[model samples]
Target: MPDHPDTVLTPSASAAGVAITPTSASARPRGRRRRRPLTRAGSLGLNVLSAVAGILIWWTLAKVGFNLPTPAAVAKQAGHLLADGTLEQDAMASLRRVLIGFCLGCAVAVPVGFLMGWYPVARALIEPWVQFFRTIPPLALIPLAVVLFGIDETPKIIVIFLAAFLACVIAAFQGVVSIDRTLINAARVLGAGDLTIFRRVVIPASMPYILVGMRIGLGSSWATVVAAELIAAQEGLGHRMQSAELYYDLPTIFVGIITIGILGLLMDRVLLMAERRLTVWQERR
Candidate 1:
């Protein structure tokens, strides 16, 4: 006869013809786990509640003469801006600059960071400069960037690039260097060449950090672009906000601030989804 399921059962087993049913290792007793996953409805309801609470708080503060604009006023302003096409134009301009700078920065940062982590000589040579540059705020370079490239697309893009590059380089470097030496040794034992090991072992293991770096870089790029646009720009969200501030158009300022936050959050969500998809091998906590 084939092996009985109960044959391998631990601790408790009934006699052979007793019609014993085996308990699965995966099965858990009721209420044993600390928390249950939130349902879709529950999550949506919670988000809606939070939004309502925020609006209420803002309204109360405005009523108490805190000189703050109410949520309703901000929403109305957002609607007007949307209707006038000003918000859309500014959003597109900002998005273009950020995407270009972010792509360029990551293109350079990843390879340099990977090399630095992989080779001791590369690390010794490049790490000091990276550390030094990282210490300098991206905004602090605005003066030099303007002097060199002028208040043009070049300067704006360069500032954004610097912000992204500095953030991502460190992340990628740490990711690569933090890898399990044992894994690399095992790959070597299996006759994997340096390039092969990097491809098959290092990249996959370090991808989490790379993606994390990119996410941070994205946030930095957005923030730096705002500061860059503040310097000199024809059309961008930051430029719009600066223009609004001069006129004391609190509603428009609020619109710009909210729009940037929403866009950043959406982009972050996209990156998180990508990370989950790519790192399916990683265990979830």
Candidate 2:
């Protein structure tokens, strides 16, 4: 094809001592490309804004008309409780119960869940019972636990243990069953024995699910402990809240609730970090 009259060309070397190039896609000066907004800063700022908004709403409702205490009142009450050592006592008591119960639950659930998943006979014998118990809320067993173990720390711990155990068992069971068969078969081809394959492949692959179950179990333990404390005993946040309710001590109640939420959030964050560390080899979206 011949160049048309409208076609423009530039000389490589000109008499004017300038080397010119054709105006083409490669020759154009690019405009300043827009940078992406910083997501972390935006997210943190948004979270702070949301918290401030929630505080304002709470303040308005409490200050303007509601019978509830304002955030300021709650803060004052929290300060008093802190100074008097009541908050520390209650928080420690609750923490103790949750940790003990959660540990017990995980200790039992993980092994039982793995067994049930690995063996059909175990699954057949236990699955029915697991399903039945899981259907019943942990709170419902409080009366039975109290009757069997007495109203002391035993009953409270038992209820929390049950709450954690059932949830964790299911999670672990699912994790075991979801393991890839190819890995197990490959191990077998490489002369790995059953025990070796299970130890090296099954356990590692199922660890993420176990951690997930532990997180769920931890939450359940906290909830059950609170309910157990409400029913019978002293020194836990639940007990404190229950006592406060008798005198309409709204600020104390708010403090206890907030403390539980904060503790739960912190524990969940720790568990999430653990899961990420353990599952580092697994592909993520």
TM agreement with the true structure for every prediction: 0.86, 0.83
Please list the residue runs of candidate 1 whose C-alpha ends up more than 4 Å from where it truly belongs after superposition.
1-33, 39-41
Residue pairs in candidate 2 whose N, alpha carbon or C atoms collide under 3 angstroms: none
lDDT of 2 by residue, 76-123 (tens): 999999999999999999999998888898899999999999899999
* Candidate 1 residue 241 C-alpha distance from true site, Å: 1.0
User: CA lDDT of 195 in candidate 2?
Assistant: 91
Candidate of highest TM-score: 1
Report residue 250 deviation for candidate 2 (angstroms).
Answer: 0.4
User: What lDDT is obtained when candidate 1 is compared to the true structure?
Assistant: 0.90
lDDT of 1 by residue, 198-241 (tens): 89888889889999999999999999999988888999999999
Best by lDDT: 1
Backbone clashes in each candidate structure, one number apiece?
0, 0
